[model samples]
Target: MAAVEECVVVIDGANVACQKDGKVHIPKLAAAIKYFRSLELAAGRYPVNCVAFAPNFWLNVKPSPGSAGPKENGTMETDDWALLNQLVHQDHVILTPSQAHDDFYVIDYAVKYNGFIVTNDMFRDHVSNKRIFHGKRLTSNWVRSHCIDFTFVGTEFMPNPRTMERVVHFQPSATSAVTTSSLHDSNDNDVEAESDDVQEDGMVVDHKGTKRSKTIDLSEVTYYKVPRELLPMLHGEGGETMGKFQEYTGTYIVLPSHAASAAPSTSNVLTLSIYGPEPSRLQAVGHLDAFLVQMQQQYAYQHQQQYMASQVHQAGMYPHQHQPSTGTQDDQMMEIDPY
Candidate 1:
């Protein structure tokens, strides 16, 4: 199997709100870049690419008066929306959506890729409604959760130096492969196999005649519905409430009634509180950082090993038991294993 490639970090320039100080306040974007760079610095790191898109308006404005302007404007209202459109074309990794709008684009992408969506939006709880749109509605919370949960891929919620609430980890769908032998099977056998076993949902038949499927247990899934008005205050969990909230029972957690009315001491202070599986924010961040470091190291090691193998092959040092062979029928028939 081929090695897993590095994750792509897509920055939503529109969702990046500018503060009164004229600086963007997106620590998530910064963290992503830092993590990716760390991987590159390690040996044999897969490429970690980044793409950023702002409002067409930003693209329209010329750096110099003589430059041409952007072709269109107002295609997207906010940076978050711009980012969502950019993510639609991507094929892998966890997609981190900002807590803006309903984050419908995030949900749509998750469903399409069978990937995870990472966000701090409290309204994500409402994903269980199973409401149909354009004639289709998700019947299972597992599907809904996969579309909305912060940690759908594995663990959700890691720590950030800038925020008390933990960040999320998103994972892409797994790729399956087929073998050459499977494709050559007789049609009669294929028909008999198809008749004996029905294909289930989320199952794929590979070119090599291998069947891959994911079995989801409906009993284990839970769905929560949250009101829209309270969304902003319930957007993200704060460090102060991390302990209390993480212990809560519901699939989703909201701020206490009184807590919603309170204002942040400073604009920089996170006002929302989100509760989830892991309790400690710092520990979560440390774990994620460690995972990234490990991946980087693993990639480096693999590259080194491959380089060494190549060198050995080039030097003609690969093991051979015989003296150099001469042209002969017996020599031509002799089998050798290439390492």
Candidate 2:
């Protein structure tokens, strides 16, 4: 009889630790993992023939007395360590030796075994330019090839990524959603709409008045006008001092939240609803801030480079006639007497 081909998975044990109200909830973590495994079995998929790399403390440490397990007939029993030990010994999950670079280890195993990786990390956070090849390897090998996303939802492990549409976004949470083998899913479908040359009193021409940007041909695109007070907050500038334009009413700014087809207008201030189940939100404010800051930095860098080049050229043209200026180089004109 031919032996069944093994279906292995490389799990990031430490990454799967559950959190509740911002701290690790050991019992919850154990319960969540159990739930995660059950789902796979129910789907007729084999349990992970896998290695879980984590710190010694994580794999072996028992929770404090009365700190874990659910009440059983009016008695709370067992902690995460007890649970971990059982799972490790009985289940197909093997506890790997403690390692600082466990993520890399997981990636290596996946590559060697032609297995899938199960973790929320993108492998980018731990990588630098020095590890460019390593990063690329992890991304192309594990992420692109096969990735089983596992997330802890409320009190249980959500094994299927498809059901993650219900995960609330942006809002503060004890534990944010985690995807095991995701690449840089840049939710930046942002558009930087150019202000039409015909601007009178700061209002850009809505040339195709009420007509949406062509890039996204959505059957329905919802736009929301930010509260006049929150207007300053959305200006990309630190919402500190008010700009002259911000103090007035009717200075409407639209935030594109949900679109049936694609993202909003080609305007810089936009965000994506990447997590699906279309949130009734105006935008992902973080993306908006990022887009604005990036644009500002690019613009500043361009001007600075231009200024430096001009200075170098001027000095080269008149090497002998060079004289130190009284004011800063940026001060093109000195404060001189009108006389």
Candidate 3:
């Protein structure tokens, strides 16, 4: 009998473990392995050759009393220790060093095996860095094709076929040519609309007001407004803040330098064009709001310091005016100088 070729897969174990409502459930990792193995066998798509890479922290978790199932313990569950041990025994689990990201090892293994990746992570930060294998660059297209996403329905593993397809694509308005990736070099000066500028409705209006249709999927884009003053803080030093936030959320965030908005309005706000899944976009929004609160607090503290400094300066200039009354009422009244 001829030997069947193996279909290799590199699973992001940390990503898989946290698949259930953003909380780590070790059973999900076990279920994921079983699901893939069963799927390969059912489809007869060659013997499943899969390996999952995880951080050492998960490997160190101690299992508590449970019926070999998921048990909620604070933010994570670890009752599936038996399954984890089984995977380890089968040499299916690989643990990354402490405090090191498993993503690097996962992608490395995938490249070495020329295998598929299974994770919901978009890997936005790593995708741009070219990982060439078999003459194929691990670009957005490659990721979309090779990555697998899944969800859990009451501990039942349900794989999603349309992996990363729902991720929003970005298109800059006609008034701006800057995208999220190039936010660092973009000028923060107000962007005046050119003769031909496109609006949110995908309508390109010329200086003469002749409107033409431009194809854009508005559904994929999310628009958020922040105070114009926060542009510096939001962009950070060389767009560092925006870059970190984007990397953290796996989303693209562009702040066009204009009053230019999705709608024609004269508001003192800068519109943030965010591109990603809905959950990612919402997460980005929360981050932005938190940043805003922090900036407001800093500004308030600075204003208070300035106010105190000014008060001290005034007191120094008019020392008598700041002195407290030290005399009796009658003495103080006479000291008022009834000239």
Candidate 4:
């Protein structure tokens, strides 16, 4: 008998956590993981490597005491906490940074391992809009071929039987390997999604009443200027800010490289090069400019407050000590111009 190949799997921890009772049921999630690990690749060999990724908030899910609500009300029970701790210690769980979403990490691990993703999420935000990431659009065909959804039968949790059957029988073809490159090439001629209704004119209408073209042109590029001082805030720690913007807008933002980002530039302004469809690029630039404006306004507000405090101290007078003036209200009020 030929040896069966081992399979790698990435589980969406948050999606599994809320599977039971619409709350964070750690035991249900643990059961799903245990079930996946128990699946046999050979007669006696369990060849499943299942890893779960979650946002950092779930790591601190402490149970509240003396609560009238149910145990699964977004709080971990004692046993649940213990099980979660064991999973963490075993290195089976990856808690992503709190400032970022776990979607990227989940998809990344799936791609890195050439594995399958188990989640109920349609990934509409990612696949539906034909969003491009890392030079490839997450096409529906790729998602359908690589992702798995699950269901619960009372207290038992398991992946969908049909999907599991397909997964177990899947064999990568010589020219159809599920890699970044294959996915990129496959998206050039996208097959219409089975779940969506397609019109004769090559447009797809999803259940949510949103319409999108069957094909998109990702060659469009646009640029916008920003103050150099606000670059760090725009990037955020580990580039989470810009990453979120890309995820939301479905556009890839090209900023300075690592060395250039860190070094102070002689120019007071920097340019942001956004790449995607025309509407997506416009949306990204608009949001980026809005964030910069908000930060600038906040800085101006802080500066004004500091100046007022310094002026009061220099006059040796407290704010409350100011006597009422006989002048009009406008004359008594001090106006500070914004920067």
Top candidate by lDDT: 4
3 versus 4: better TM-score goes to: 4
1 or 2, which is superior by TM-score?
Answer: 2
Model 4 lDDT tens row, 149-176: 9887765887888878755654434113
The RMSD of every model to the true structure, in order and in angstroms, is: 25.7, 21.3, 17.3, 10.3
Count of residue pairs whose backbone atoms collide, per candidate: 10, 10, 0, 0
What is the TM-score of each predicted model, taking all chains together?
A: 0.25, 0.37, 0.44, 0.57
Across residues 1-339, which tens digit of lDDT does each residue of candidate 2 receive?
Answer: 111243445566656663433234445546544544443322353343445554443443334455453332211224555666666676534554321234546665654444556666655322211121222222222243355667665765665555232221111121111222322222212121222122423434343431232122111223332322223344445432221222221122222212211221223333222111123122433343564466555555666677768877999999888787677855742332211
Error of 1 at 111 (Å): 3.0
Candidate 3 matches the true fold with a TM-score of 0.44
Tell me the TM-score of model 4: 0.57
Cα lDDT, all candidates? 0.32, 0.39, 0.56, 0.64
Can you write out model 3's per-residue Cα lDDT over 161-274, one digit (the tens) per residue? 454232112111310222122222112211222211234124333423211111111134477877766666666787777766776775666565322222233466766777
Ranking by TM-score: 4, 3, 2, 1
Please give the range of 10 consecutive residues that has the lowest summed lDDT in model 1: 175-184
Better of 1 and 4 by TM-score: 4
Error of 4 at 18 (Å): 1.7
Q: What is the lDDT of candidate 3?
A: 0.56
